[model samples]
Target: MTIDTSDGTPAASPDRPATPKTTPKKTLRPRNRKAQIITVAREQFGRSGYHNVSMEGIASAVGITAGALYRHFPNKQELLAQAMLDGSSSILAILDEVDRTDSKVVFTALVRYGLDNNFRSLLFDQEARNLTPERRTEARAGVREVTSRVAAALRHERPDLSVPDSVVLGWALTSIAFSPARHRTTLPRKRFEALLARLFDVVRTAPALPEEPAAQPQPTSNFSHTSRRESLMGAAITLFDQRGYRSVTMDDIGSAAGVPSSSIYTHFGSKAEVLQAILARGNETLRLGLVQALRNADSREDAIARVVHSYTNSVISPDSAIAILIEETANLPEEAQASTHIAQREYIDEWVHLLGNETADARATVLATISMINDLTRVRLESRQCAIEDLAVRILATQTV
Candidate 1:
């Protein structure tokens, strides 16, 4: 008589005394698979944004089944929360190890840490908003701690700067470091690090702007849009900016615009189409403004100033749609996202071309400078335009240095 083995092969005949069959061993996952999952999830979330990536997609990217992914993370929120927690913890640990007395030392360490873990920095900036309230609080607390530490370091180094200025400078340096996480570049790592260090020095030594009056709320016009399509577009941009694109629905938008939910389709095919239109319009406006600014300039410096002024004005206005363009672009449909990105690249390339730095390092520097100005917009400077323009000039000076 023959006995079947677990592998479905018949065992050796008993007459041969059948050397004992060896049972096949099941493959074991790496002990740190959970950590691995979080790492992969960070890259996915950072690249695709939180709303665009799915649990199954993450699992596939990690070479695991959806069931296995669940075995590690109960749901997407838990995974995102864990990723943010891990990233924040890592950044804090790096900050702790660096000497905080010297602003340069702290800033250099931050730039290195940020570049080495660019994906993690992107997670903190872009995906942290998707976490649950509790997790979001935890992440924000950690970031605030790091920011406070940097601010203290800035104060220690520059006793002349006011408390507010020091805090703003600290945030500025942090934004400079995180800038690389937002774009792609081919500059060598060491070269990029050196450029960032120089940029930090420029920011550190720059003269402070005079304080201005508090920001006054700009008056709004009472006139209403006669076109339903225009009204819907306006309402959608506002809602998309306030609540992320994923959270806003057609019905919600219709109510906000006073259009029937069923009629929204008559104007636009879907919510994604609405976003596409918004992005296209914003891109065109920026492109046209920049071209006009460049055309009217007499010299390289004049052109740079004009471009920076125009770009800053467009982004800083209360009614500016640039925020939606920046934050929600990743949530767009693939084809629309590609088109927007192409347009943005052309825009950046124009800046780099105009900067007269067509090399990879120069391109990277230009992008970083733009990023610094863009990020400073969020700081609520008293003299917003003057501060931005001064900082832009200072940032541009670093490329020559």
Candidate 2:
């Protein structure tokens, strides 16, 4: 029987041909199968995170039964851990590509390529600990080295900055590139640049950090339209973000969501299901935020402000998805990680599309927009604050200019 890979792609059975053509003399090559599973597994993990997916689910996606998958991996954890290994290798290739070059252009191009394709993200910001202990240790070791190299590159560019590489500052910069932010989400590329330029002027010219923390928002009151599933998800986000995903059990999620734990079986089979729900919901909210910003924007300038308002609201204000996404960074398995990445890509692509699909600068605009989000997230993670309206306006003005 043929098993589907985790990404919904079919993998042809190697033992036999569909047409009944006997090629018994053929030597089986493992590379082809390994590559196929890697692709599917990455898609699953990126979209779902770690705890939310199953090996059986991944096997089904690959067009193979879970029993069939056992031929390749000892168990689900092995599959996930190996997927992380393969994904990290792909990233190392990208880093190696530019290791010889000092040009920021190459760095920018690499970042641009990553945002456009969502491939590099598999490397720099993964949640791959769902693997078995033996494999997980190996995977984490590799991840640390890869991150160290990336951090070194960033530090190379910003030699003037006081923060050291591989620490909170480094993690913060990497976080910006991967996380979605408001000001970056709403405005056109030209206007967004203006916003960045203005911010830099202030950063370079100012004598001290801003005195106040970013503004606090009111708690959500729009549950009127939310479903039981969504309520569970929303409640789960609050709890998961507060207590951490692994520490919180399925029972806690069920109790907090006010749904019978069994309802989770109906809506989502496990606590992991609830986790994926939070990740997916975060992506959806960001998408909706962009749409709302566009609708509310009276001018190019205003558009950026609306986006900033949405992004800031989501990340800084105790929203469900933001912390959930970050928390999942170290614990996702192959199937869950890839799926989450694809979902986030779809959102970023929408931003790219917003820059005008046929525009010559569309890709650059999207990457630049992505870069802005990275910067905005940097502020939030480092200082733990952001000015929603101000950040959005600055990004919009820069891009417009």
My TM-score estimates for the predictions, one after another, are 0.86, 0.51
Question: In model 1, what lDDT does residue 372 have?
Answer: 69
Task: List model 2 lDDT by residue over 1-401, tens digit each.
Answer: 98854554344478744454355788554667767776777667666655666778887888777776778878656667777787666656766777523423333433444454454343333354345567767886665555455456545655654443223333333333332221234445454344333433432222222234656796977548447777777777777655558768877877877778667678877777777777777778888888888898787556655666676666655554866665574455668878887777677665555444524234344444344444445333434334323433443343343
User: In model 1, how large is the Cα lDDT of residue 53?
Assistant: 84
Q: Which stretch of 10 consecutive residues in model 1 shows the poorest summed lDDT?
A: 119-128
lDDT for 325 in candidate 2 is 66
Task: Name the regions of candidate 1 deviating beyond 4 angstroms.
Answer: 1-29, 120-124, 213-220, 295-298, 379-385
Whole-model lDDT per candidate: 0.79, 0.56
Q: Write the per-residue lDDT of candidate 1 for residues 126-200, one digit (tens) a residue.
A: 455567779878876776676677789888887887887776677677777877877888567888888888888
Global Cα lDDT for candidate 1 = 0.79
Clashing pairs counted in every model: 0, 59
Candidate 1, pairs of clashing residues: none
